[model samples]
Target: MVERKLFAGHAVRRLRRTLALTQAAMAEALDVSPSYLNLIERNQRPLTATLMLRLAETYDFDPRNLGASEPGGGSDAIRRRLADPMFADLEVDRAQVEEWLAGAPGGAEAFARAYDRMGQGGAASDGAPDPASAVRREIERWRNHFADLDAAAEALADELRQGSGDLYSAMAERLRVRHQMSVRILPVEVMPDLLKRIDLHARQVQLSESLEPASRSFALAERLAQEAQGEIEALVRGAGLDRLGERLYRRHLTGYFAAALMMPYARFLRACEATGHDVELLMRRFGATWEQVAHRLTTLQRVGARGLPFFMLRTDRAGQVSKRYAGASGSPLADAPGLCPLWGAFDAFERQGDVAVQLAELEDGSRWLTLARVVQPQGARAGGVRARFAVVLGLSASDAATLASARGLDLRGVAVPIGLGCRACTRPDCPQRSAAPGGRARLVNDRETGLSPFGFAGD
Candidate 1:
């Protein structure tokens, strides 16, 4: 068999720049001549296995990352973006898109961002970035894993476990002892609009009485995570976000810390593997909710002790995505403005509380194993209207064999064809398309209509 040489020049250059090392200095550290190192960085030479081992040993970085494509900047994403109606006249091809990504990744990212801005009603008039999008980008850039926070939360979890009580009791006790604060579950009438509030003057962490036991524990953990303000702030600062963006990101980081505390990395991973990535089983073991477990699954990218590289999406009934995290799966579904109605997430609402699984094939021929379920948000009024949501967790179908959720399934069977959205999708024969595809000429005939409402010129 011919050896597949790794041409990861951009990754090498990125690493070199991140280490703040001159080419010559990096070359010396890698035990390679500067000229050869330059060749390696320029794609003129393949990164040999021996050199990969040396790079890992000397730099203490993940070798796998050298070959991983940037999220939302891969050739598939670029090709999909170029398929927009605005670029239809350009007639960009797959090879050209791959060349662009390979030769100038930064340029490709800029193009993707510009296209995204156009899709989102063009760049801001005042040039202010959207805080939500900015924060999502930062999370994607980190593959939804913060190692330092994970470590800190794991250590805290160990300390909390030392107490001879439930996790929530232990956390409350720690708060009372360490921070001189007591937890009080106030009645709904007392706190009608607030789920949780920290009264500094009274030295109490007050939560609404309507909160479930799991939510109560999560609220306490979120408060406890604030104790790591220094570390979390350091990350927020490093994100280089605007004021609102920083605040939003800090909240997200606090939630991450809470999740990590609730489901410590090592123990959670073991439970997942043992249960075949069963969401309900993990929730039962960790005293968490389904949404919490699904979200935590996406953050198990902790290097050597990694879990499945799951990507999660949470959307309302109308398909408005509220949260998305594309771990290491490189799934573009997380980046789409809207989801295809044909995906399993929509079906989850119909099944309501039952797990819906699908083997979905994208336009780019990538297959994903998606597990979706409907979940009610944590806080709901006693007899008032409540909202429901669908949470979809997916990973590459190639990795589906290891999941208990995917067991006894026909991995080789036909898959449901899905796309990013009606506008961006190029699937011509989809019966569920609500709008005409971007780059296709609509086919009009006086006497004929096809499966899709909007017939278009085929590729």
Candidate 2:
């Protein structure tokens, strides 16, 4: 028979040493006697139940792993803290940090890392991001945009569900009555607001603004969506999605109308399913960019139609998180903590010119299938410098099995150790990083390297 042992005494000793915290400090945090902590560290005495709970609850350490077990998820987040310069001020030992990570996990670190990343702040700058103001702007925009769309969709959904002769016909009838002009799409070179009403001679249409290919496409889509609002509403209402699921469903419903007016959903869905979610095929079918194809793919899950549920995020080289949208009828990530290393989505950007596909599991014990690739967009006309953005999409692992990559891998009952690669991340030891944003030392620098990148409170 095999013999069992106590928790990882080595890990306890190591974590304390790495944090550069003295035995007294550790004792204070754990609410235990310094002598008791010293004895536990030296393995002279086992950690008691009260001490264990204190470590887990107070300092956010895991008591189970204290006996002796490999670290599970969230170790990356914890490890990132060692990279902080604060540790350097006190001279935390590297061996100690590694040993601590090798210990057992407390709870989920995925959410914790995300919260830390976004909440971290630095010294003041003249023209930097004002998080408070930025959040207010985003909230206001969402309230206005979503509230209006929700009202419009609700009215149309009720109208069609109550008495539907045909979805598009009703919406089209309403549009013609309101605008008194038929929807006509012309090739690019012509639109100036991108839409307009011509009062010349007999009668005519208007162009709101001159559009580049992408903008022109969306313009046509918007008009199409307006024309077929009734049909789209019917499709959304019939889906029977949960509240969060319904929000995502309706958002996609509107997008479907826009895309359909251009490429048509029936045709696109058939083509996509036939091709097993091939980007090239979908892009060619819709005359869209790779990013657009990725965004559109997230729209397939509606009305329990059994489509892959996906979330999409787009960011530029400057690290501006421009767009983020969740797809499908449901997601534990419908409210993901935001970008964090434990998630492993950013690893896709390692190779500048390649598409990186990865399977990631969150701290919640749920798995996500991800596809990430970079896109370089040229500026409009003349001489605008090239711009680059990384786009990523993720979905529930089970819903993505139609793809061959996820088939053989045992997503459940298995834990994968992923690294957090940047101080910008929850992962530590990412040499590629120059410094944390806002020029502060990372929260984890050890004493030897007194100059850690940047220090953020969440760490």
Please, what is the whole-model Cα lDDT of each candidate in the order they appear? 0.82, 0.50
* TM-scores of all predicted structures: 0.88, 0.44
List model 1 lDDT by residue over 1-459, tens digit each. Answer: 133466677788889999899999999998899999988876668889889999899989777566443534455455645555556557788777656656787887787666554444356666766777667766766778888899999999998888844999999999999999999999888998899999999999999988888899999999999778888998898777889989999999999999999999999998888888988888899999999999999998765587887899999878899888877666878666558889998999999779999999988888999999998865677687798999999988888888888888877689999988887777777888888777678788889787877887766
List candidate 1 stretches off by more than 4 Å: 1-8, 11-25, 43-98, 112-127
- The best candidate by lDDT is 1
For model 2 the local lDDT of residue 13 reads: 68
Model 2 segments beyond 4 Å from truth?
1-217, 228-256, 263-268, 328-354, 361-366, 376-379, 404-459
lDDT of 1 at 15: 91
Give per-residue CA lDDT, model 2, range 209-246, as digits (tens): 43346544554345545545565565445534445545
Candidate 2: worst 10 consecutive residues by lDDT? 136-145
